[model samples]
Target: MDTLEKEDLARYNRQIILPELGITGQEKLKGAKVLVIGAGGLGCPALQYLVGAGVGFIGIVEDDVVELSNLHRQVLYGIADIGRSKALAASEKLSLLNPLIQIISYQQRLVPENAEMLFSGYDLVLDGSDNFETRFLVNDTCVLLNMPFVFGAVFRFDGQVSVFNYEGGPVYRDVFPEAPSEDQRPNCEDSGVLGMLPGVIGSYMAAEAIKMITGIGTPLSGRLLVIDLLDNSSQVFMIAGANPDLKKDKEKSGTEEAYAINLEQFKRLSDLHAQRVCVIDVREVYEFEELPTLALNIPLYELLTAQLPLDKILVFICQSGSRSRMAVQVLKGHYKGEMYSLGTLLFK
Candidate 1:
């Protein structure tokens, strides 16, 4: 409450005047601590509005670097940031926008082990993450910690938003009990998304987070909001809590380290005999026109719905390896299958 100085009031004048979010509510916002996972398309707007609105402490957890392709949707970055770390770039931009706020950027990936511990520190966690593995891990960990998190996801022209693990509310595991197997899931890199879609969805997430922090109007707990940008159609549905497994998943990640590969390790693996490992291509049909040696096209969107024979060791493949890395997570969601990704394997 004491943190709201004259500068803060001047900066957030518009929002502070709202009946629901007056000086007192804005004070609550100033006192709140929020963590946003993934600093890409969705994270850009979510973090922007939250920072511009004057949240005192904001934490960004991302393990990605900027590239030429990401500039389309990730508004916080630019051509000058072609090779900089995403979390750093995002924080730097946020700092320029509002120096009164605190921004902590962790330039590392989130895994099952670290996710839970991080969730405990923040008042709310907004998942702007793209992959299913991190999504599931966030849901499970937050559910265990009883944290309030705003969830937003986008694909092509469609997007979905929900609030999970809020006080006295249902968690995401309750809504999505299992990950969409191989054929059912798709990633943004392979599916193609409208740049503004994340802006639309992410802004909603920021609004939800602000409400949760300020105790404003009802949030999206126990309800799902689906938006289609193409037709400007929106639908709201009630999601009942029926999955007992969501409650049964009581495990906690107590400093357990998650495994990840760096550029060198990724290269070393390719030197091995390619035939020994089966490569699963998650790119769509048309993208496969220029096929590579020993590559199978699964096209990310078709995962979870497609049945895999479970015949051999599978190495998921996608452009730049981001989508396939996410695919491995989704596959791990439904089945205990052995899988890995050849991140950007084609370049070398």
Candidate 2:
């Protein structure tokens, strides 16, 4: 650990004085490398505090450009930053805030192809991405890399924060095994999040990151903190049963390239009577009746144990695209025919 310089002591005097986080903890923060996913609402606030606290190496992964509308909640950018890349803009501002720290900006989306490579370089990850696909990808990548991450999400008046993949604790998959269907899951654009919601949740996320890095306080590893700012009510739910499958190596798991089909493509396939396409709804039994499409109901929990037909093309469907993706993972090597996940599919 590098000794705190005269300038470092002055800059971090307030936090350095805390007995729980004295010189040793401050030094840990100075040596820690944290990668924050997304530079929007949640990422903005997280970046501010993490940098402000003197995290040594911070990386920003975002492909979005600042827009006029993003100014409301994305606190890192200003009027002059509109049309600029979010990753670059955030890195520039964070560099100015903490000149002593190193900031690496990747102005690209966090796709499955690049996730593993990017994650290998960081000690911890902070997920502030708005979409479930990215969230799942981050969770899986972290689990694969044996890295812990702070997860935060804000929807309207409600926000949630959790720590996952920490010391064999429960992960995002243990809580939300599947994502809510497209129509059921609304984005900030459609539903509109309160401007202050992300700030509150992002700050909590930053706190979790610091705790994980410094080993000072108990981190929310197996619990989900749900906060309703509207009523100021908060609840902590203990998540049970971390999925053992997530711990499997990606190459050995055979899920590196699972096939996916959209609703339109599914409809076209159904219309063609040539192929034996079997659509399977992997949601719970109670959710089976609510689906608009005709399909066999095989809950995701029972998928691996159930003897599925191997001759037919299997198409998995769930309320949101999450369960279907899990189903694809379960049936990857066992099934001989082509498989598909109706990920992020919205049925009219």
Candidate 3:
């Protein structure tokens, strides 16, 4: 194990003064290796705090370039860094913040092919990915590698932080079994977000990492912290361990309704009543490169005014079932037809 030097002692004197995290905890942080998934909103703040804490080794994985839009939240970069690779730019800035630690930059996307190899080298992973596909991919890969990860996500005025797969605790899948496809909903770019929201969530993610590394406070394993800036409130929810029937339990508890059915049920409806069954896809036109033959494209926003066959059994579909459910609700009394929402169980 590597020990902290005299300069390190001075740099982390404030935190080291804590009764729980003294010289020994500082040494643990000095020896820890943490890999962050993105250099966007959440990653920027988390990286800065972790670097300042003297984490010995840190890796940044990002394929995006700095854009003018990212300036509000990604404070690590300046106007001069526009168009620069996020991983490289963040690495350079973090190294300047703490030259004593090592920073590695992987200017590439975290795809399935490279995920396992990259994840195997780190003691822990901190996911700051924006998309659900990447987030779920990270969780699955970490579970396969038997590694724990800190998860953070930010929306317009809301954010969430959690520690998953730690000490045999609940993983991301335990809480969210399914995710919407990329086209299901708009991202921060489309929906807009509060500039400082990621900072709050990312700081929590960094604190969780530090606590896990130093063995100081209790990590958020099996617990999720949700922050809502709009209401100026926060709440922590406990996550149950992996259960194959978690989704079923949710549906049984009335979280999901009878109007929501799986793909198999949708297919059966289409097969049994071919002429009477109609599938309406409530995704944006941009989301589809080529529309599926089975469904008609009707973006959620235009669904209310769209013409539809009143005699047909309507099945609404989207990247995730969220918008589809909304569609069903919107057309319930208006459209005199049997309606169903094919949630995430139905894919492109």
RMSD of candidate 3 to the true fold?
8.2
- Expressed as tens digits, the lDDT of each residue in 84-132 for candidate 1 is 9999999999999999989999888999768776777888899999878
Q: lDDT per prediction?
A: 0.78, 0.84, 0.84
Identify the runs in model 3 with alpha carbons over 4 angstroms from their true place: 242-348
> Which stretch of 10 consecutive residues in model 3 shows the poorest summed lDDT?
238-247
* Segments of candidate 2 deviating more than 4 angstroms: 242-348
Instruction: Provide TM-scores for the models.
Output: 0.69, 0.71, 0.71
What residue runs in model 1 are displaced by over 4 Å at the alpha carbon? Answer: 242-348
C-alpha RMSD by candidate, in order: 12.9, 10.9, 8.2
lDDT of 2 by residue, 1-348 (tens): 767788889999999999999999999999999999999999999999999999999999999999999888888899999999999889899989999999999989999999999998799999999999999999999999999999999988889899999998978987677776766565678879899899999999999999999999999987777787887877665453333444354447665333667777777877883468877887656456545556777866566567888788788887667667667766656677788887542442
lDDT tens digits, residue span 1-348, model 3:
688888998999998999998999999999999999999999999999999998999999999999999999999999999999999999989888999999999999999999998898899999999888898999999999998999998868878899998888888876556764556555788888999999999999999999999887889886667787987877655453233365467767866666878878877888899999887787666564444535788966466667888898988876656567667756756787799988652544
Error of 3 at 134 (Å): 1.0
Using TM-score as the measure, name the better of candidate 1 and candidate 2.
2
The alpha-carbon lDDT assigned to residue 144 of candidate 3 equals: 96
TM-score, predicted candidate 2 vs. hidden true structure? 0.71
